[model samples]
Target: MVLATPVYCKYYSKSVPYEPVRLQKTNLRFYLHDILSGPNPTAVPIVRPNQFGALVAIDDPLTEGPEITSKKIGNARGMYILASQGTDLTLVLYVDLGFTTGEFNGSSLSVLSRNPILENPREMAVVGGRGRFRQASGFITVKTQYLNTTTGDAVLEYNVEVVHP
Candidate 1:
């Protein structure tokens, strides 16, 4: 009188309704200007009371091209914290990139990942998003296009690939 054989499969379809959705891939390339030392720095350090770690908040500009003079597109707004306990310039970053022009206007994508600053090209995961990029999942690769350690300014080239419905 025992007929229990994997109850999960029996009700799996009932509990989770299947809906047909079409996902599209979007590729975007932009540049971020991280100015850490200038008078109008885009990235600033947060002095914590405990002062045990390092954290920098950023509202950096996103441009259509790698150069600073390129047409402004949007902003990469978020924060990056020191991830490594040692001398490795690694960072845990969280950012929301919002577009201001073109077809992607009003849409945004979010990313949370570890950034190895010393690496030539760093890869990061795009967790989620809103607007046109709802339920987004993808990755972004960044390369330091230009950097001035003296002024603490950097221009990073970002290539993003995202899939969304």
Candidate 2:
């Protein structure tokens, strides 16, 4: 029998783009609740560690104006894994968020991030994507604007810097 071997190659330097497109949106919050039931159920926790799921309605300023309305141009939902890491008791989270509709109507955007959740300003990597955002890769910055403890409702702002062809 002939011996089989594996070969690997590595590159030290990579070319960088001069200018990358930046997308910014403010006053965006995800209303996570069951709509068919009428009025927020107020039974679920806004956030928790480990596996969790919710039906999200993306409230954007352009379409919904400033008021919180049921009209959603798109949907946002994700699964998460949260736990303590290292000696500092840092709350590390693994999040996979999927987006559809609006600018992402036909296609979808998938974001995967493994980072500390306790931080005021957090960043996540755009590992993969589909549709208009096909092969999209970049980083996103998240800022929590508001959080309602009782209803588990929150407002978050996002700044995305991405490279797509």
**Tens-digit per-residue lDDT, 139-159, candidate 1:** 999999988868668999999
lDDT for residue 15 in candidate 2, whole number 0-100: 83
Off by over 4 Å in 1: 1-16, 48-52
Predicted candidate 2 versus true structure: per-residue lDDT over 1-165, tens digit per residue: 999899798878988878855643322334332222225432233554343332223322212222246455454444333344443323233333345446555654466665454566777677756666676678777665666655445455555666665
Q: What would the TM-scores of all predictions be?
A: 0.85, 0.52
How high is the lDDT of residue 94 in model 1? 93
- State which candidate has the highest TM-score: 1
lDDT leader = 1
Worst 10 residues of 2 by lDDT: 58-67
TM-score of 2: 0.52
What is candidate 2's CA lDDT for residue 61? 25
